[model samples]
Target: MKKLFTLTILFFSLVAAAQTEDATSSEINENATFQRWAIDVGAGVHKPTRPFVDGYVSTPDLWQADLGVRYMFTRSFGVGLEFGYNNIQSDADASVTFESDYYRVGLEGIVNLGDFVNLKSASSRFGILGHGGIGVGFLTSNARTLTDATDHHLNFTAGIAPQYRVTKNIAVFTDLTIIGTTRNHYGWDGAVLGTEVRGFEGLMINASVGLTFYLGEGTDPADFAQDPIEAKVDAIAAQMEKMAIENADDDQDGVPNYLDRDNTTESGVRVDSKGRAIDMNKNGIPDDMESSLNARYASQSDVQTAINSANAANQNQIKQLINEGYVNVYFRFNSTKPTTYSLGAINTIVQYMKDHPSATATLTGFADEIGSPEYNKSLSERRAKMVSDVLAAAGIDASRLTQNGDGEDASVDKNSTDARQLVRRVTFKVN
Candidate 1:
C-alpha cells in the first residue's frame, strides 16, 4: 500500500508536466486523447548483501523471471507495477538451506520524453522517458538445516530510482534501493571465533531491469504519417505560404539584376516583366497544367493537344512541388522584367493559384550586388512593384495580394560578385 501511494505521488508529478503540449509540435498537430497499456516479461538475478544472516543460516539468491503491465493515461505519462519472485540460497556446504522464496511487487512512474504531436495520423510512434518512483516489497524465506526448521518474515523496501526510457514501448533502467527487512534469528552451527555466532541483519540493495510496450493499435508513424498524400498537402500549404510572400508584388519583374519577358506571371514564379524572349515565340509546355493548356490554345493547337499537354505538365509540376515546391521559381541574373519565354512558367503557376483560390500571394524583392544599399533598396522596390502590377493584371483577386519589398537588404551573399545578380530577383509566395 505504501509503494502504491508513493508511486501515485510521483505519477502525479509527471502528469503535471504532460499537461503542456509537445510544446514545439503543439502548433503542428496532436493525437486524440487516449489511454494505452503494455506488458513485459523478463528475467533477472538477485543477490543479498550480507554473507551471514544467522551463522550458516542463509538463503540462495537465484535468478527469476516475471511479468509486468503499464498504463499510459496520456502520450507523455504513465505508471507501471511489476511482481516477481527470487529464490534465496545459502552456501553450498548446506550450512544453511534456504529452499524457500520471496516475491516482490513495485510501482514506478513512467515519463514519455517525446511523442508524435501529429495525432491525425495513425502509426506506432515512439517517445523518450525518465521516471522515478518508490516501491514496497514483501520478502519471506525459510532456513532448513537437517530439517525444514525454517523461519520467515516480511519486510518493506523504500527507495527512489531513476530510469532512462529507450522508446515509447521499451526502456532499460536501474533501480537504487534500500530494502528494510524485519529482524530474524538463527542458531549458530558451532563456535566460530571462540564465541558462538548468530546472524547479521541490515538493509540490502537490489538492481533490476524494466521494459514497456505501447498497446496502441495502428500503423507506424513513419509509414502512416508524413507519407505521399500528407507530403502533397503540406507542399500545397507551403506553396501557398510562398505565394503570399511573393504576390505582395506582381511585376514578376519585381526583381533586379535580371529581366524576364513575361507579364502577369504566376504568383510565386519570378518572371521578368522587361526581358522579352529573343525567340519571341519561344514556347514549351509550361511545367504546369494550366500553363500547358494556355500555351497550347495560344498556339491555336488542337483541343486534344492542349488537354494532353496540360495533363503532362500537371504531373510533372506536382512531382516538382513534392520534391521542391509548387514552383521552384527563382530569378536569373540581370533580370528585372518578365521575359516572354516565361509565359509557360506563368501559365503553370497561375493554374496552381486557380486550383487553390483561397490562397494569398506575397511578393518579396531582392537586389544583386552592383548597387549601393540605398540604390539597391529602391531598385528592389521597383522590382517588387512590377511583380505586383503583373499579378494584379493576371486576374488574381486584388485583395489577396500582399506586396512588399526588402530591396538589397535580404541579399543572400554580400561578398560574392554574382550574389547581387542572384539576389536581384523577387520571390512570390502563396499561403
Candidate 2:
C-alpha cells in the first residue's frame, strides 16, 4: 500500500507537469481556458454491503477517506488517480461476523456531464462529475468463523462527485461511490454452507466530502467557466484590461504617452494645450526649446541631451496624432486582411474622425522586402486600399481619406523581425 501510494504521487506529479506544459498550444487559436488541473482530497463513510457471503447482515457503519488528483485534457474528459483507506465493521447474517480494513487505489476516467448539458447557469456555483476505475485492494482482516490474515485483491470503483465551487482556487466536493473487491477465498471455506458465492467478495459504498484545489498559471474563475456568455464576457474583459494597460499614462498626465505630445513633463507641472511643458520664465517659448538653445550656447556635450529631449517630444507628438487623432492598421505577410487585434485601433480612428468632422487622414502602407518588388508593391497597395474601405464603411468620407503604398522602399529592416513588423503596417496621418 505504501509503495502504491508513492507510485500514485509520482504519477500525478508527472501528469501535473505535462498539464502545465501542454496547457497552451500554439496550433489552437482559442484562449487557454480549456487547460485545467485539480487535486481533490475528501473523507466519507464506507458501508460494506456484504463481506464474504450474499446474506451477510449490515455492521455498524464503516468509514473511508481518500485523496485524488486529476488533469482535464479537455473541458469534458479527464483522468485521475485516487488512494484512500476503508474500515469495515464486523457483522453477520445467520452464520459469521466479518470485519476488514483495506487500502484502496484506482485510476479513473472522469466525465463532466455539465459540459454537455446546460445545467449550469452563467454564474452557477456548482458542478457534477462522474468517474470510475479499477486497481489493487489490500485488505487486512480477521473473520471469527472464516479466517484471520491479510489479503490483496483486484478492486473496481465508480463514483459521482458533486462539487461546489467556492472560489477560483478552492471547491468543496462530496463523492458517492461503490467499490467491489475480488472474492476472499481463504476466509470463505465454511463460513456459510448455503450462502451463494459470487465471484467478488466485498461490496462497499463510500461517501466522502473533500476540497479540490485548481492549479497552474490560469487560475481565474473565468479560465474554467463553461457558460458561453460568461466565457465571452471574461474574454472581452481581459482584452479591455489589456488595452487599458497598453494605453495607460504612466506619468499620470492627462494625455497618455501613446497620445501625449510631450511625455517628459513632470507630475503636477503645468503644460500647454499641446502637452509641452510651459516656459514660466521665457517669453512663451516652450521649456524644451529654451533648454536646447541654452545648451547649444553653453557646450556641444549638453547639446546632445537637449537634442534628445526635443526628439522625444517630437516623437510623442507624432504618436499622439497616430494613436489618438488617427489610427493604424496592421497586416499579415502577403495578405491584405487586417488583424483582428487591431479592431480597437480602427475604432479609435473612427471615433476621432467623428469628433472632428473636418479632419482628413492620409493612409500609407508599406511592406517588408521579402518578396519581389512588384509583388510587394501590389500587396502594400491592396493593404492601403483595404484600410481606406474600412474607414469609408465606418462613415468616414472617402474624399477626406487618401491612401498610398510605399512598398519595400519603406522597409525598416529586411532581416530583423522587430524592425520588419513596422514595415507591414498601414499608418495614417491627420491632414
TM-score of 1: 0.38
> Model 1, stretches more than 4 Å misplaced?
1-35, 50-52, 55-61, 111-202, 217-431
Report the number of the highest-TM-score candidate: 2
> Which residue runs of candidate 2 sit more than 4 Å off their true CA positions?
1-31, 53-60, 91-98, 142-148, 186-201, 221-224, 227-431
lDDT of each: 0.48, 0.64
lDDT of 1 by residue, 1-431 (tens): 34533545766677556555345445444343232566755555555654244444344244655566766545556666766566656567764455545566766566654333443343334333444444444344454342324433234443333334355445454443444344333222211122222332423454556554446653222112233346558889999887776554434436422333454333343343453322323343233323433431233233235435656776443323422322322344435675444444355545656667886767677766555778777767777677667766888777876767676644255664333333445556666
lDDT of 2 by residue, 172-209 (tens): 98889877666445332124324433565556788898
Instruction: Point out the worst 10-residue segment of candidate 1 by lDDT.
Output: 187-196
lDDT value, candidate 1, whole model: 0.48
Q: Which predicted model would earn the best lDDT?
A: 2
